[model samples]
Target: MQHRHACERRETGGDRWTEAEREAVARDHRDAARRHRHRGGDEDRGGFRHKTFVRRLRKCFEDHGRFAGADLTRKQALRDFFEEILLRRRLSDHHSFTLLGDLRDAPAKRFPGELTRRARALTPHLLTTDAAAGRASSARPCVVLVEADPASSRVATSAVATAGGEVAAAFSSQKAAASVPGTVLAIVDVPDRGALDAVDRLVAAGLMVVATSGAGSVALAVEAMRRGAVDFVLKPYTPEALARRLAPRFAEVGQHVANASEADRAKADFGAFVGSSPAMLALYDEIARIAPSRAPVFVTGESGAGKELCAEAIHARSGRAGKPFVALNCGAIPRELMESEVFGHVRGAFTGATEDRAGAVEAAQGGTLFLDEIGEMELSLQAKLLRVLQTGEFRRVGEAHARTADIRIVCATHRDPQVEVAAGRFRQDLFYRLHVLPIRLPPLRERGADVETLANEFLKRFASEEGRAFRRFSPAAMERMRAHDWPGNVRELQNVVRRAVVLGEGEEITPEMLPAEVAAGTQRLLLERIDEAEVEPFWMTERRVIERAVAVFGGNTARAAAALEISPSTIYRKRERWAELGT
Candidate 1:
């Protein structure tokens, strides 16, 4: 039986408490109040007793206790129980649930059209989307940030998340004076000398600390680095600045294995993307070759093939690197609102129009405008976009003034623009103007062993994300991945790896942990066939299979041996003999 006498009911249905049982509940409320009056707790805090009772009940259930003769897992039982307790008329307070605030199960209040009318006086602030900002996120660094004030903490938190850096935890000065283990970095917002000790504590715990402060706190910023901080940035933080500072750290995993010459750092990395394939290397060279040009570039690729990353890399390496890279998805916004989203609207321009707003073009002034899924844009909007490209001017909705946007255009689409033009769905003139420079990205299936390389990088990244001990994939699991054709490309691989990290508890991932569809695909792997007509020697065929498996599994000798059903020492000796032969 439940410990609360008021909550206990003789009826099997929780909501069927009779008038006599309600009287018993009212009496219990009065008796509890009488006992409370003699104690040192507040009597005016209206829903205190009910809240305390609910919390205690939840705790008891979590600690392995159960209500008498009742199955808590049944949906109706829980619903009726909450309804009875929450709706009960208390003898101590008239309006029982008013004190529960927004937590009460009720419809949210709305001012409707009145709020829209009032919003005409309010203005919305806009942030510049640097070309770097328009790219899809790869992996975020796991880090903590400390701030003394609530307002500053919230500001810092938003900046970190926007930049693809996960803030693991936020702490104030009064919290536990320690840093969390396994955190890659900590950004400390030091208000004064008092907070300096916290930075030192984090450093002593073997964490990399970055100290930050406002303009007036230069002395503190300097002192923090002097004590132990690895880096420093001034306050009034922007996500772009932080991203640029940590760019190297984001690509550190690929850099460890990237076999690039000193003259070819550009070949090894482009924004957040990293790969060692010949196609990727060639793409990197092409991006580097065109960074100085202001000509409009149209990037074509299958979905999830990193078209946005290509645009971001060009912008990051170009002259407009300091300016915003504004990205707008043409397919995502409605045709009616697309005008307002791409161009600013003055207040009273429409029904819910607020004050003045800067559109993506204005935000990208002197920078780059990345238009994703441009093929999906309405034909009418395409004409308007062409005008902006022809002449650097565009007017706001409901305004006569024509503003000039000095920005470079970087457009991407998975569809063929020429096909769209031939079908009359896209304007022919606009296609010619934007397609001055064309770059094509290859699909993941054609990238060969890069699938395993990308998968391993994701493993390390998501292991940090989910706070678990996930290391590598078992040999059979790796072989399973190498055989399946990833039609969804890199993005699909990222999601699968993240899911396995979240769900799999073992140190190494096995084929059983794969998604149902992927596991089915693994059964259809194309293996070599043997024939008596004409074939290579048995030993040479075995060597070739071993070599192919080693390449696909990222050159792991042990994993290759397991996949080939051979001993690790055998493969090791074979490699040693091959190296000696220099064949």
Candidate 2:
């Protein structure tokens, strides 16, 4: 009955709650919260008394069933209203968390927009303040106008602002467009070849460029496309017409521009890492949360997955940012001199020890010591290292007195430490001591579009170093790169991009310019898919290979097994099963 009355009242009130209705609903909520408190249920934990909150939410839904009008979807309308209410009410953090959690866990079908603004605005410490700031900055899409004439630029800026966008900056030259940050798009009036070159630079900076050319300058339009302009418009276009034409492009690239801006911001915080993928962002958040601590951090990842960089990031974020960060590669050093490398050597300690020398630990005093490939450290050394960690003291080679150590230990290993422990190659206690805080880096293949971000960054860097004209990757080359499984990870990708920049002569890198291995593999996979009509069963294929191997080995199963890297008993068992199946 109350829901029906609310709906009728809402219908009469022109699809919006009246001031009296809002106060009545707010009063009801407060009364329910008071009742919950009187029932001995903590307000912080209960979060608006779940049952009553849902009842109110459903009532609002019913009253506002047609509130979306035609332009706004029901989901968006609910979210906008909810956000406005939250802002007006100024809910407590605990209440907001509980409310957002319930909304987050609910099915997306029931709520579109997922209350993204609300969740981002309410998430504790993660995006709360930053999200608010981003919201403010993104209230209007920002456009950069690159027109040489002052009067024309003023006109364009006013048009853009009037068209529901903000003029982030107005530059008279295309050369200045590349430096503009947090822009959705750039409007470039290309009158000459120099402006066309500027279009290239802006595109290289990841901004979508819209080149405006005179109607008779068909050659200029063609050149603009070649120079990487996404869309070109003929001059003498009106604000409404231009806006209509560019609206679709803006919608398409809006999210991408936002992400690029976010990545740029993230670069300021995580200097060594260059990605905004969810995995990377989560990793960044984790690093920030854990940076202030003094616990030893153990980083584990594939050889080129940036374990050392992760350690550096942790150190940079920690209290030791201003201190020295000494890194030692345990695998690169010889086992015979491992002890002397970790602890400084006294004079006359060995044949080469002519004078006193400080090792990595000493060099890293009051800072961080990054030990890469630590699993390669011998058991004897591991035991000694464990003592230093426990006692905070170490003795130099051939020294009788122990020196105090005041440094954080951050160790990394490509190999599994547990496997080394089981093999008795590493001390168990040392592993435990360093493994207090463990960070596992995801391989590049799993980082998704981060591959593109990293590839572009590497291209820009290497292109300048090599003094090449390489500006960007051709679409085909980029697709092939994203398709390939990067076995060697980021290091391999870096080398590939560097090689392409060195050998390629054109402004855009093509598929042929890529290393033969990556290009050929892509072609081979495509050919395999197209040429193979019938797929053979795994057992048939396995039998064919095994039969061929046995024939090549003169019918000796053991020799074939040895060549195939499988047990001879396993081959015999497979042969018995094949015979029974009459294959």
Candidate 3:
């Protein structure tokens, strides 16, 4: 009768609690709170209440803890229950249950009906979450505990489970974490500096990490954050506190992994470039195809659009990878010294030529010579550069004999080569000479979602270098960055991130931390809204934009296609369709 009454007080019901029963329950609540407060002693900031933890453990076992046919005792069954259900740890070699495959590979009926129903209910949300961010969010996201110490791992696993998240355990290798299919958020134990490499590997694999360290290791915690841990907690943290810290990030990464489109999770890196957008992938393909040939590659793009990096990638991919790659900025050099800069000069060739110096051509022998801002080279120097490209031989200044040249030339300019040729500032012969393989880099605004990818990468690198606490950008800042027209391209974005890391405090980089120009860019759209009566079909707007582009280039669909960051074939196809529709 006493046990029944106690159970009644514990369960939720209006059974008319006696004064004695009421007092007993109140005392229990007070004791639970006190234990929760001091469970980890002086070092622990917050902790799980032992009574609550044990009660939940018992309840989970009662529901799903079945040891069919095996002669396991009750104590052994309880241990397996804690490991398999609450901790979500894999028991691949267990006699009865083996979670040895992908999360989807597990049979639906393996668990009871309620758990299966819960997973199915989470499916739609998983599909819709953070698709643009390139996260593989179709499966249920798991909190992976990456700790070498078995004790710490168990503690973290329980805490994550207590906070109502699926949990998994991985040790020193972090290979097990990778094997667990789904979106993963890691809780890495940083006992010392030796574990930083594990943090790096997990981050590079695109998992979000929260570093946990014991007290008096603030420096290591900061280093972990610098190494791309999203957040950190001190040792002996409470399940409640861990949940509170993880909630925002969980929402940001889109609740948990769910089924997503292939393109959404495509690899976003090629060579030194970090983007998976169609334009960048196409550019990468083009570069690969052109790198084998000995043709002079001409690159055009807005300034700071990674034109030099493009040149380096070309050099790296070509057969000349072992040779030196010499870069000369034609615009940065004076006209008087431009000739000597391109070709070697003999001692006493001209003023300030006291010693024999090798120019870019000599330095780039058996390799590639990158001439940046070739449009800025004077007409006189253009003739000389053309001579080298044509004859593959050139004399140094004040030299009688011509030297044989063995170098591939890769030139880049911010200005359009055709426009420069037409203006007579650049030689038509030289323009054709270097335009054998033209690559036009798309501006940042046109590369969808790459902006966010780049921002996160820059944040990680800069945070590490500057030892800042910033781990990720706030949602508002990410939106602002995406909306801003990065006129200066990648360089501008790098500078903004560096500034934020050096000056901004806190874990998240907010919009206020960004430059005034970038933050204000959100409101810079030409048309903020269209009235309901004035609204028209999207095709009409697209047609107008396309037609305007074509008209601006004087009916040259190829040039207009380049300007629009689309293919000429696409323009032709769209035009034919529009004609048939007769809009």
- Return the top candidate by TM-score: 2
Model 3 TM-score relative to the real fold: 0.50
TM-score of each: 0.47, 0.54, 0.50
How high is the CA lDDT of each candidate model? Answer: 0.68, 0.75, 0.70
- Tens digits of per-residue lDDT, candidate 3, 425-500, equal 9999888889999999999988988899899999999999998888899899988898899999999999999999
Candidate 2: regions farther than 4 A off:
1-258, 523-583
Model 2: per-residue Cα lDDT over 62-122, one tens digit each: 4544443222233233444554555545665466556665554455565444243233322
Q: Where does candidate 3 have its weakest 10-residue lDDT segment?
A: 95-104
- Clash pairs for candidate 1: 129-325, 130-324, 130-325, 131-325
Give the lowest summed-lDDT range of ten residues in model 1. Answer: 120-129
Model 1: per-residue Cα lDDT over 43-92, one tens digit each: 44443455444333333223212232233232233333433544553323
Stretches of candidate 3 off by over 4 Å are 1-269, 525-583
lDDT of 3 at 367: 100
Per-residue lDDT for 424 in model 1? Answer: 95
* Model 3 residue 396 distance off true place after TM-score fit, in angstroms: 0.5
Query: On lDDT, who's better, 1 or 3?
Result: 3
